[model samples]
Target: MDTYKNVVRILDEVLSLEGRSASFSRDTALLGAIAELDSMAVVSLITALEEQLGISIGDDEIDGDTFATVGALVDFVDAKLKD
Candidate 1:
């Protein structure tokens, strides 16, 4: 499975982006840059990602840096899947 694409799809669904997230590149900023990505959204996103991808994410594993960019988020998800 393609982790990057799956991550993007989940982001779009969780954030209610309506396909806007489809254009996000690796460099595209997320947390602070996106208006829809508030703290609650982050939690919802984490839940959605965990449920959809079959990965478990501990609270300590998350931080602003994890959602800094599209690529960073994908990398975080990839790493979580490995464990």
Candidate 2:
């Protein structure tokens, strides 16, 4: 699966970024960079990731690093899918 693309899509939908996320690359910062990605949006993003990606994410599996960049989020989901 293209985890990176899926992560960007879910992020755009969850954060209501319209199509802006289409330009996001793996190095694109997320956690403290995007103003739309507040705490509530993070929760929504997590829920959306779980629902859309068909993966259950334990709360303990997430942290600041997971949201640090688009690459990190995709890696997390990829890792979860592998597990």
Candidate 3:
């Protein structure tokens, strides 16, 4: 499966973006740049990613940088999957 595509789908669902997330590229900014990606949405996105990707994310493994962009989030998930 395409990790980036999956991540985008999860983001769309969790953030209720109504498919708007489909247009996001690797450079697409998230977090502060995106009004929908507040604290609550971050938690929801994490939960959705964990459940959908069947990966466990430790509390300490995440930081602001992880959600800084679409590429960053996908890289974070890919790294977690490698472990």
Candidate 4:
């Protein structure tokens, strides 16, 4: 789950949560559920994940569900890496 940890780090930094993301779990709420996960944050997160994981995120691939939870996000990143 290295990608998961990397994403969590990105989220933590993007949201300025002071490492609060360390406490997040698979079921943790994201996207619109998190105050800091606005449109700009989404763009930043996508860019960070793409750069860090060396994967391209398609424009059509962007969706709220992709950022719904830690597990979902991990799954997305894993899928991208596999491609």
- Top model number, TM-score: 1
46: Cα error in model 1, Å: 0.3
Candidate 3 regions exceeding 4 Å error are none
Error of 3 at 16 (Å): 0.5
lDDT of every predicted structure (CA atoms): 0.95, 0.93, 0.93, 0.88
Candidate 2 per-residue C-alpha lDDT over 2-35 given as tens digits, one digit per residue, 9 for 90 to 100: 8888999999999999999999999999999999
In TM-score terms, candidate 4 sits at 0.92
Best by lDDT: 1
Q: What tens-digit string does per-residue lDDT give for candidate 1 at 3-83? A: 999999999999999999879999999989999999999999999999999999999988999999999999999998888
Q: List the residue pairs that clash in candidate 2.
A: none
- TM-scores of the candidates are 0.97, 0.97, 0.96, 0.92
- Worst lDDT window (10 residues) for model 4? 1-10
Clashes of each: 0, 0, 0, 0
lDDT of 1 at 65: 99
Off by over 4 Å in 2: none
Q: What does candidate 4's lDDT look like per residue over 1-83, in tens digits? A: 58778888888987898989989998999977789999998898898888877999998997989999989998888899999
Once model 1 is optimally superposed onto the true structure by TM-score, how far is the C-alpha of residue 47 displaced, in angstroms? 0.1
